[model samples]
Target: MKILKYIKTNVLIYFLIGMFLNSGLSLIKPLLLERLLVIQEDQLTLDMVLSFILYGFCLHLIFYSTMLLANFVSNNLQRHLQLRLKNQLFRKLFLEDAFIDDEKVSIVTQEMELLYDQFFLPLDLIIGKSFILFTTIVFILWQNLWLGLFFVAFSLLRPLPQWLMNSRLNNSGAAFSKNQKNFHLSVGDFFRGADTFYFYGVAREKMSMLEKYNEDYENARWRNEWTNNIVFFFNGPIEFFSQVLPLALGLVMQERGAELTTAGLIAMYIATMNINGPLQSIMYSVSDIQRSGVVRERIFSILEDSSVEYSYHTVDNVSELVLENVSKNIGERILFQNLSLNLSQPSKVLIKGASGTGKSTLLRIIAGKIRPDTGRLYVRTSKGEEFSQFQGNIAYISQHPFFTHGTIRDNLTFGQEFSDKQLLYYLDQVGLTGEIPSILDYHLINNGENISGGQRLRLELVRCLLREKDIVLADEITAALDRENAKRVRQLLSSLPIILVEVAHHIDSEMHYDQMINLKDYR
Candidate 1:
C-alpha cells in the first residue's frame, strides 16, 4: 500500500485498462484459430482465408500496440517509484545521527535494483496475466460449463507447488540476499586491507579468507536456485496436466454427446492453451514476489520508519554557552564528571585534557552530536534568544575532518550558493590560497587525501567562516600540523569573532582565551 502511494492514480487506471484490453485482444486469436479448425474443407474459400489473415494481422498490430503502451506505463511507474524511494533514502542517509550499516548501504545500491526487478517490474505483468487467466477461463465456460469447471479445478492445483515450497523459497531467498551483502562487505574489507596484508606478508591468508566468503555466497546462490528448481519441477507436471487433461476430457465429452459440439470442444481446447501460459506465469510471478519479501521489507522499513527529526531552534547570534555539572561515562569509567563552564560575550574557551579525558566527547556534546549523561547545556544569543542546548547552528571541526571527492568549491559550499570572491576570501583567511594553486578549483580525492593535514583542517575552518557560524567546536584540529601551520591555525581560531570552544592536548601561550578549563580538575 505504501508502495502504491508513489504510483499516480490516473496512470494506474490507464495501465489497468491497457492490460484488460490486451487480455481481451488475446482471446481473438484463440477464437480465430478455433474458427479455422472448425471450417469444413469443402467450405474453405480464398476470401475466407484472406479475411482471417487480415484479421490476424490486425489483431497482432493492436495486441502489440497495447503491449507497447503497457510496457511504457510499467517503465514509467518504476521510474516514479524509484525517484520517490531514492529521495527518501537520501534524506534518511543525510539526517543527523544517521548510522549507515552494510544492509542500509546495500539497500541503496543492490537491494533497490533487486526490488525493482523482482517485485515492481513484474507486478504489472502479474496483474495482466491474471486477467488473461480469468478471461480465458470465462471464455471456456461460455463454450461448455462442464469443461470450464474441470479447468477451474485443475487450475486450483497450479499454485500448490508454490505454496508447498513457499517457506523454503523465502528462507533461501533471504539467505542468498544476506550472503550477497556479506560477500560484498568481505570483498570491500579485503581490498581495504590489501595494503596492510601485503605489508604484513599475509596476503595469501587474506585471499584465502576472501575465497571462503566467495564460496559461501556461491553456496547460498546454489541453494536458492535449486530450491526454485524443485518448485518448478513440481509445477511442470501440473502445467502439463492443466493443458493436456482438459483437451482429452473435452474430446471424451464430445464423443459422448454431452452437449459439446466439435467446434465448441476445439474452441475450449484452444482457450485452455491460452489459460495455461497465464496460469503458470501467475504462479511463478507470485513465487517471485514472495521471494522478494525480505528485500521489499528492507526497503519499506526505511520508507515507513520515523527518522529522528529534530526541530532546530534558530537564533540570531549565539553569545554564550554554559555547561552545568556535565558528566559522561563509558561503562564504569567516568571520562569526566561535574564539569561546569560558562562562556559569554562571544568568548574564546580552551579545554585542556590528556588522552582518555573525554576532551573530544565533551566537544561533541556541545556540538549536539551526543548528549551528556548527567547534566544539561544552555545556550544564549545576543538577541536574548535562550535555549537549553545548541541546535543546527554550531560548526564542528574534527581532527579528521569530513570531505567528499570534489572540487574545493564543492567541499566548501556543499552545493550552497557562494560566489568565487567570497570563497577565495575565506580561503585567504585560512591561509589556503598560498599552499594550493587554483584554490577553488583544486580537486580533493578520497576525503582530501591529495591535500596536507593542515590544509584539510584549514579547509574545514574556511567552511565555518564561509557559513559565518556563531559557535565553533574544534577538536584537536591543529594537532597534526607543524609549528608554523599550527601557529597559523591557532591565530585564525583566536581571531574569529565567534563563540569558540576548542579542546586540544597542547595549550599554546600565544593563543588568547578568556577561559581555560582543565577537565581533570572537574573530575
Candidate 2:
C-alpha cells in the first residue's frame, strides 16, 4: 500500500525495540513477584527488601519511559501519514476538476479523520499489544506446558465472536459513512443558501430539511454502535471464561499433587489475566480495523485514481483562436450545433445567446475548462505554430470569483512577487484603492465575504491583470456592478490591448466590439 511508504523504517525500528523491551520487562515483574512470594517472612532482610523496591521502581521507570517514546513515535507516524494523504488529495482534486462536488468536502475532512482514528492509530496499538501478548504467552508456556497450551486454545477462540460478526460490522459501518456524507452535503447546501432562506422568511424549512438528514445520520450511527456492542457482549463472557479455565486447571493439577508451588499458581492467575487482557483488546482492534475498511477504501480510491492524460503545451502569446463546426450538448439536449468563430488578432468579441444557448459553455470551451462534443479548437501563436488545445495564455473570470482566505495582497499576487505600487496601480484602475485603506495588508475572511460583491469582482479583474494573460474570457463579470461601475469596468476592458471574449446578457450602447457571435443563429 502507498501508506507503507510513509512509515519511517528507521524510526519504526526504534519503536519496535521499545515494544519488545517493554513487553519483555512486563513479564519479568510476574517472575519477580513469584520469587518474592516464595521467600518466608524471617529470611526477608532490610537489604533484600530495599533491593526489591529499587528494582521494581527502576523497571517501571524504564517501562514507562519506553512507552512514552513509543507513543511519540506513533504520533509522528500519524502526522507523516496524514500530511502525505492530504497533500495527495489536494493535488488530485484540482487535477480532476470534473470529479469535484460537496461530497469531496466530507472526504477531505471527516473521512481523513476517520482514517487516522480508526486505522492508523488503532493499528499502532494493535502491533504493540500483540507483542506484549506474545511475550506473556511465552512466559506461561515456559512456566507450565499444559496451562500454556490451554490458554492458547482459549486465546484462539476469543476472536471467533468478532470474526463471525465481521460482515455485519462492515455493513453497518458502510451505512454510517454514507449517512455521514449525506448529512454533510445537506449541511453545506443549507449554509450556502442560509441568506436566501433568512431573507425570504423560510428559515423553518431549512430546519425541517436538516432534521431529516440528522435522523438518517443518527440512525446509522446507532445501528453501528449496536452492532459493536453485540460483539462486546459476546466477548465479555468469553474473556471471563478464558481467565477462569486457566486458574481452574492449575488448581486441579495442584490437587493432583503436580509439581506446582503456591507462587507458581499465583503467577499462573496473573498470567491468565494478562492473556485475557491482550486477547480481548486484540479482538476489539480487529473489529475496529474491519469497520475502518469503508473509510480506507474512500481515501484510497481518490489517491489511486489515474489522472487525465494530457500534456499542456504553452505559447509565448496567442495570435488567434479558431473553432470549426463546434457542437455541445447537455445529455440529450443540444445546447449549440455547428458553431464556428475565428479571431486572428487582439480584439473584443461579444457572444450573445438566449437563456439556454450555451454562452457560458462556449466560454468554458475556449477557456479549456471543458471540451466540445464535436469539432476542434486551434490556438496559433504569433510565431505561427498552431496547437490543437487551449492550455495556456488565457484568463477566465466567472460571475462568482474565487478567493482564498488571506490578505488582499495574497489574493492579488497569488504567492507571486509583485511590488505594492504595481498592485495599488491596478487596484486604483479597478476603483478599489480608495475603498480599501489597508491596500495590501487588508485581510479577507471566507473568500472576501467582508467585501462587497462589486469589490470581489474588481479584485478578480485585478488578478487577471497581474497574471498578464494574453486572452481574457469574461463570463458576465459586470452583472453584479451598478451601471456606473459596470461602465467603468467595460471601458477599462475595452482599452486593454489583449484579446477579450465576453459573454453578456446586455451590452453597452457605446461600447466598441470588433465582432459579435449569436448562438441562436448557429442553432
Candidate 3:
C-alpha cells in the first residue's frame, strides 16, 4: 500500500471523472450537430436544439470545475513531496557522517534541484497523460475495431521520436547540470579570492579560467537545446496526422458507398480529432516523465548508498581513551602506522608535531569523522571495561572554527541552556570580556565575521568549555591569539577537569602538561 501511494491517488478519481465527462461531451456534439443539419426542415425543432446546447454547456461546466479541483490537489501534493525529499537530503548531508567526495556532493546538490522540479511538475503530466492515453485507446476500440487498430498503429510512430528525444535529453541534461555547477564554482572561487589574485597579480589568469568554464557550459547547453528542438519539430508532424488521418478515413468510407450518413461521417471525424488531443498530451508528458526518472534515480542513489555504520556501543562513564595499533593510509601513501596513545580524563597532554605528520588525521579518527582501516579505539569506563565506541565523551575542535550567525553570547552558548552569569565567567576567562563593553546581545554575522580572528578563536574555546565534554581535542587553539590572550587560554585549558589532547606547533615548556607526545619520535 505504501508503494502505491503517490500524488496521483490524491486526485486521480476526480481526473478520471472529468475525462469521462469530456469524452461524453465530445461524443454527443458531433452526433447532435449532424442531426441538426440533416433534419433542418422538420425532424429538428428549436426547443430540441436548445436542450442539446444547454446539456453540452452543463457538461463543460462540470468538467472545468473538476479540472480546478484536480489542479489544486496536484499542486498541494507536489509541494508536500518536494519538501519531504529536500528535508531528507539535508539530513543526509548535515547529520550523517558519510565519506562523500567533494565532486560527488556538488553533483548530488545540482541533481536535487532538478529532482524537486520534476517531482513538483512532471509527476502531474505522467499521471494525467497516462489516463488520457488509456481513455483514448478504449474509445477508439468501441467506435470501430479496425479503425482503432489503424489509429493505434499510427500512434506508435510517435514513440520513435519519444525514444530518440528521451535518450539524448537525459544524457545532455545531466552533462549540462554538471557543467553549470563547475562554471558557477569557478566564478565563485574567482570572486571570493579576488584579493589573493590581486596580491599575486594573476587576475588575467583567473579571467582566462572563467572564460574556459563559460565556454564549456555554453557547448553543453547548445547540445541539450538541439535535441529538444528535434523532438519539438517531430511532434508537429504527429499532430497533423492525428487530425488529418481521421478525416481522410471518414471521406474514404463515404466514397466507398459504405451506408454511412454525412452526419455519421462527421461524428467519426470529430471523435478522431478528440483522440489527437490526448495523443499530443501523452507525447509531452512522456518527455517530462523521462526527465523526472533521471532525477529520481540520482536522488535514490544518495539515500541508498552505504555509509560508515556507527555502533550504538557506549560506556557508563568514560574516564580515558586508548588508541591501539592504529594505522591510516590514504591511497598508496601512509599517513600514520601502528600508533598507540592513551589520554586519561582530568589530565592534560600536548601533541607536538610538525606540518604533514598526521596530527589532523589522528584527531579526525578520534572524532569519528574518519575511520581507520586497522585499529581498535577503546574507552575506559568507570565500570572497568574498555568499550569500543565511535562517538561519545569527546568534543574535538578544528583549526578553523565554524560559528553560526549570531551575537557573541549566542555563539558561545550555541543554543544550549546557559545562564548569563556562566556565560560571562567563560568570556572573562578567555579575555573576551573587554571586546564588548555593553551587554552580550550584540549581533554578529555567521562565522563571527564582525569579531577578530583571536576573538573568534577565544569564543570557540569558551563554547568548548560550556559543552563540559569528558575529553577535549583541540588543534592549534592558540594559533591566532596574542601572547597575553594565548596565556589566558593556556591557563583556562589547564584548569579543565576533562582530558585535553592538543595539537600545537608552539608549546611553552613552562606551561604545566601531564605529558608531551612528540609525533616525530614515533615515526
User: Each candidate's lDDT (Cα)?
Assistant: 0.80, 0.81, 0.69
Model 3, span 1-523: residue lDDT tens:
2212333564546554544444443344555555555655665778877876886677667666656665665566666655655655565565354434453455356666666554445556556655555655665556566655666566656667867657677888677766776886787688979999989999999999999999999998798768767887886687567556855776787698766567655555565666556666666655554545645665666555556234334456788889898988878767777878787778888888888878888888887767887877878877777866736567777668877777767777767799999988888888778777753787778567777888878777877888677778889987887888888888888888888888887788657888887777655
The candidate with the higher lDDT, 1 or 3, is 1
Q: What CA root-mean-square deviation does each model show from the true structure?
A: 2.5, 2.9, 4.0
What are the per-residue Cα lDDT tens digits for candidate 1 across 473-503? 9888888788888888888777777788888
Stronger candidate by lDDT (2 vs 3): 2
> Candidate 2 clashing pairs?
none
lDDT of 2 by residue, 1-523 (tens): 5677656687667777766766754565686788789778989899888988887787778778877877777677678778887877876775456555665666788888888787887787788788888888888888888877886677657777778888999999888878887788888889999989999998898889899999999999899889989987887778766777777888899899999887887776677677767777777777677777878887787788776433455677788888899999999988899888888667899998778789999998887768899999888887888887656677888789978899999998988899999999999998999988887899999978889999999999998888777789998988899888888899998888788999988776867999988888877
Q: Give candidate 2 misplaced runs (Cα > 4 Å).
A: 5-22, 25-28, 95-101, 199-201, 308-314, 322-325, 338-342, 384-392
Model 3 alpha-carbon drift over 4 Å, by segment? 1-50, 95-110, 118-120, 164-171, 255-278, 285-298, 308-316, 390-392, 437-439
Candidate with maximal lDDT: 2
Estimated TM-score for each candidate: 0.92, 0.89, 0.85
